[model samples]
Target chain A: MAELELSGVSKVYGAFNALRDVSLQIADGEFAVFVGPSGCGKSTLLRLIAGLDPVSGGRIAIGGNDMTARQAGQRPVAMVFQNYALYPHMSVFENIAFPLQMERRTKDDIKREVSRAAEIVQLSTRLQDRPAKLSGGQRQRVAIARAIVRKPGIFLMDEPLSNLDAALRMEMRAELTQLHRRLGSTMVYVTHDQLEAMTMADRIVVLNGGRVEQVGAPMELYHNPANLFVAGFIGSPPMNFAAARVDAVEGHAARLTVEGLGSFAVSYDGKEVSAGDAVTIGIRPEAMLPGAGEAGHLSFRMTPETVERLGLHTIVHAPVGAKTFTALFNGDPRMARGSALDVSVPLAQLHLFDRNGAGRSIRDIQ
Target chain B: MTFRSGAADAPAFNQNLGAYLFLAPALLILFLSLLLPAAATIGMSFTDISFLRPTNFVGLDNYLRLLSDGRFQQAVFNTSYYTLGVTLPTMVLGLLAAVALNRRFPFRVAFRTIFYLPVLTSLIAAAVVWVYIYEPYSGPMNGLLVSLGLPPQPWLQSPNLAMTALIIMAVWRDFGTAMIIYLAGLQDIPEEIYEAARLDGAGKFAILRRITVPMLSSVTFYLMIILIVQSFQVFGAIYVMTGGGPLGSTETIVFQMYQTAFGYTEFGYAAAMSTVLFFVILLFSIVGTKIMRKGEA
Candidate 1:
């Protein structure tokens, strides 16, 4: 297995910049995911690392060797495309044996290796069937088997599970994580699904607008998103954002006033604050409690417009001033539409951002 | 219940009638142009109705004569050779041209149009142009040979070279059709297949042979049947350029059929020949279509 390193890598297509100065390192045996919204350069970065697309600037190294100028086949890397891309005319045996055949390996060796790889993916029973005869999940397994048959140092997958249905995606995700643990090979996967990233990645590299927004473990990114983009993108129902203004500053604590939510004092680290400075506050939907619990908590009144009782938790969506606020409560609460309720979030969970869209909370400051 | 069932049957009958109405024009054209002529030819094959004599039922007389006819056998051989000669080369040239023009380039569209121009040209017009090109004394064929320090040779005038020369012209005119069909088939193949092949370390030629050729077997079979059927009825080019030519060397089945019916007024014999050709082409078509469907499945 080999670690993958990209330094100052950039890709430009005519007037459009697909990836800009992207640099990251995936440790050997790490399941690093490149996660972002569509057209956010995550797939582009994966392709660059795979050597399928050439970089416009900087370098890519795999196993500490320069692979920036190498052809895709010449690199010590294998890719599983988004669509599986199995050769329709080939049987599963031939599909998995393709890379070995390309290397002109001995017939017996090819058979042995192909069978082993297929067995790992639990596809040994369907060896003689053509890809057309197989289901979508089986075809995906064939693509993976083909990639693994070559025994490449690094595996690159470009949104490989996006085509499968939800149930199959979850099963494949668990299988892939188990496969990673079994093989101990470096894998760089790209996806626009944050849930996939959160569940599967040893580290998730969040990208936006052709640039790296943040890079951390799943919970690390969830707990401490570096900017507004990561904060909005990393969580489901996303984190709620509200405009607030600093009413006054006292030493390391700032008193902020939010329209319709009254004023509260939040302790900070090193960020300089002055009177009447506009700021944004973020709190996740799940962090908001049902009632105004005790004093010193940021509390607000909201009229529920819609309520979704999802058995274990009841999610309420309501309007607070100009923005919609979402609150998730454990167990089903008697929440009704058009009814006003007070919700509170602990001060420690509030995420503060300045006017520039940069995180200015205590976690970010330290 | 009876009334409701009767009302439902009425709409179903009307729907059937509407569908038949939509199909009527095409069915009428097919019957008048194809089925009627085939049936008439088969009936006429059993008769000696030449219009110059009292019509009589000849029964198996025409068939028995055809069995012993030396000229007819020669025409059959020449037609087979011409079909084999044209179909293979045309398919190869067409596939190569299609693969080349499939890529993006500055003049790709212009090149594709130029390559496909021959398919749009009239057969009579193209045959006349080729006849001049093979005109021996002043033709460019001999002119080019003489320039290359070789002695000039007559192309269409020599019995040995006339059939070959006709086959060449027919290939030049027909490969464009093969190319267009192949281009359409190429479009049906996904681009990701090629990219996967490239990433698998397959070079250009390997991908064409292993992936492209196998994937397009159905298209190739279809083109072969079409070319063979068209080649079996190779009358217009032969009639215009060679007219069955020097020493009857290029006398194909359809060309001989034309001469037999018109020149000798042997309409019964010509009808028998047409019936044989029709059956042969039909067999080829049925086999081709069955294989294509199986491949798709």
Candidate 2:
């Protein structure tokens, strides 16, 4: 196991920057995931780390050695592709034995090692079956077994579960996490799913438009997002934002007027804003408590347009002035369309952002 | 080509009659074009049917004569040699070209088009061009050989070099077909497989040998059979360049059959030669298909 470091890593393709000045340090045995949207450059960053593609600028070092100029085969890494990419002609035994055979290991050693990996993935009985005969999950297990047999310093997975069905994706997610726990190997996984990153990563590097938005633990990013992008991306149903203007600034406290809503007193810790400054106020959907009129909480009256009762909880989608906000409640309120929702945004859970989309939680208002 | 439109009652007599009626036109074409000629050839092989003489049933005479015919034996040897020579090198070169063009390189499309140009050329047109290239004097091939300090020998005239020269020309003319087919096969392989293999520490040669060749076994087997079957019936090139010349050295089975039937008016003997060649090619194709099916499983 070894640490992986990227120093100012940049990838450019004919003036389009796929990744720009991305620098990160992943400690040995850490399960780091790069999560982002479709064009967010997460997969590109994984490719650069795997040595599948060269960086247009900067260096990559693994285990304290520079690997920027190394070819993919020269790197001490194993990759599991998105489609599982098992050699269709080879049986599970041969697929797992591939890397060891590439190293020209002896017959007995390859057999023993392949069997051990097959057992780890619970594919021992299907060792002689070709990839075409295996199910999607079993195929991924073969790919994982292939990577494990190599005993590489780092394991790279690029959207490896995206091809499986939803049920199998969940199953493989848990299996992959357990595999990482057992192996204790440095794994760099890339996926566009925020849920996968939230569940599997030791630390998640959220990317947006070829740049790092924020990198933190799952709950840390959920509770404290660094910017408007991270705040909007992390949580399910996402956080809602409403345009507001500052009316007064008084000793780390700002009185803001939310358009189409009402005025509120919010605490801040900056000289960055003054009267008449425009900002967006952010609140989580679950933070909106039903039946308002709580002191220090901003209250608003919205008309519910659609209500989704998901057995365990009720998701009330209501329109407040020009924007629609989602309010998640703990119990089904048997609410109907046009029902009155006295939604209250708790003062303790406010996320303040400047007009430039930068977070101004203003030094821990909570 | 299978349909179950009335398959619920397919076993009923009248229900099946409609299926047979619908299949009649295609079945007629198959009988006239394939089955009839094959049967006629088998029937004609037992006779001495020629324009100058009465048609007489000769039983096992022609078959017995073929076993001891030295000229026919030489033709068989030449055909086998040409088929093996052309098939192996053509496949190898075609695979290499397909692999090279599969990568992203400048002018890759232009190069691919250039390689496939010969496949679009007519067989006779390609043969005529090859004849010019293999011309004894002042030809491009001879000119280059002389420039490289190699001997400018008669390419299509010498008995020792005649068959080899024909096989080389055939390989050059037909490898474009192999390349195009191999390219289609190459496109079906996803790019992720290469990435996974590279990360598995497989070097360039190992990836090609272990992954690429194994993954393309079915395609290779398919191309092998096609090339073999096509090469076994080699006629046009020999007709244009060699004409079975320089002591019958380049005479293949089809060339001999053409000479027997058209050149000498011995239709019966030509039919026997064709029947023998057809069986040989069918055997090879069957064996090749079996290998391909087994590889897939």
Candidate 3:
């Protein structure tokens, strides 16, 4: 295994930049995931690490050796594409043995290594079956087995699970985690699905518009996003943002007046703000409590627009003033549309963003 | 509203019938143009019909005669040579041209249009042009040879060179269709497959042999069937350029059939020859399909 690093990487296609000044590092035996929305350059970053694409500018190193100018085959990395591009004409065994054959390995060694990879992927019984004859999951396994048989220092996966159905995707996720642990290779995985990144990655790198917005553990990103983009992108049902104005700025404590909820004092540490300066108050769906009336509670009346009962919990789509947002409840609320109730945004779970969308620390406020 | 309303469904059912009725004329025209003549040919092959008389009930007489006729035997040999000569080279040349054109280059569209110009031109016109180009003394081909200090020989007038001339013209005229088909097949291959192959340490030739050729079998099978069928039916070029001349060296089956029917007015025999040609084409198509299917399996 090798530690992979990218410094000041960028990719430009004609006049458009596909990836802008990006830098990241994956320690040996670490599973780092690049997660973002479509066209966010997550997959482009993965391709750069695999050497499938040349960087317009930057240096890439593997095991402390410069590999920026090397060809994909010359690099010590293997990749599993999203489509599982197994040769349709080759049998499962041949697909797994292709890299070894390309390297001019002996026939006996190719067979032994192919069989070992098949065993690891639990595809021993399908050695002779062609890719067309295999199931979707089996074809995916063949793709994985093809990558693993090479035993490269780094494993690169580009949204490999996005093609599978939900249950199969879950199964493959678990299998991939086990495979990573057993192989102990430095793996760089790319996916637009935040759930997959949260569940599998040792560190999650959130990207937006070809730039790395934040990099941290899953919960760290969830609870303490560095900016508005990461805060809105890293969670399910997304965070709710409401326009607010600074009502008062006293020492490190500031009194913010939300559009619908009147005024509430939020602890924030940043440059002193004018009374009419606009800011945004962020709160996750799970942090909003129903029917909590207290001073500085940030309470507002919401008319339940829709109720989605999801067995273990209920999701209430409610309209507060002019905007509609979702709030997750632990039990069935037995609530119907058009019902009115008061919801409170807990100050501890609340996040305050300046006009530039950068987070302001609450401790600095006091 | 009731779920089963009879009045509401009547117009919808009648519209369906009216649609089928409107399609009758075109369907009838197609059947009359193609299927009727095919059925007549099959029935006429069973009789012995001379040009000026009623066809007599001669069971398998034409078939028997064809077995011993030296000219018919020569025609079969000539047709086989022409088919194999044209099909294999055209396929290879077409594949090469397609691979070259698949890359980006200046004026690519213009080049593609120029290469495919022969396919769009009428075959009779192309053959007429080629006939002049193959003239023995002053043609460009002979002039080039004379300029190069090589002996200028009779091209279409020589039995040995007549068939070679026809094969070359056929390849030139027909390779565009095959090239277009191959281009489509090459485009259908996903870009990621090539990327994966490259990352697997495969060089260009290995990728072409192991990835491209295997992936292109289905297109190859299709092109081969069309080329073989067209090769056997090669009449316009042979008629316009060679006229089956130079001791009948270029007398293919279709050319012979045309001569028997029109030049000699031997209608029944000509129909019998047409029947034989049809069966030969069918045999090739069936055998080719079976081989391709077996390879796939």
Best by TM-score: 1
lDDT of each: 0.89, 0.89, 0.87
lDDT of 2 by residue, B25-144 (tens): 999999999999999998999899887889999887887888899999999998889989999999999999999999999999999999988888888888888888889897788899
The candidate 1 chain B region of ten consecutive residues with least summed lDDT is B1-10
- Best-first order by TM-score: 1, 3, 2
Displacement of the residue A305 alpha carbon in candidate 1, Å: 0.8
Interface DockQ per candidate? 0.68, 0.76, 0.74
lDDT of 3 at A159: 95
Clashing pairs in 1: none
TM-scores for chain B, listed for all candidates: 0.95, 0.93, 0.90
**Which candidate do you rate higher for TM-score, 2 or 3?**
3
Model 1 lDDT per residue over A1-366, tens place: 999998999999999999999889999999999999999999888878777778999999999999999987898888899989899988999999887888999999999999899999999999999999998989999999999998889998999999999999999999999999999999999999999999999999999989999999999999988878889999988999999999998987899988778888988764656788888889899989988767758887899999999999999999887899888889998879998998999887888877754554433522
Cα error of candidate 1 at position B15, Å: 0.4
Ranking by DockQ: 2, 3, 1
| Model 1: interface root-mean-square deviation in Å | 1.1
Task: Residues A172-215, candidate 2: write the lDDT tens digits.
Answer: 99999999999999999999999999999999999999999989
Answer with 2 or 3, whichever has the higher lDDT.
2
Residue A13, candidate 3: how far off, in angstroms? 1.8
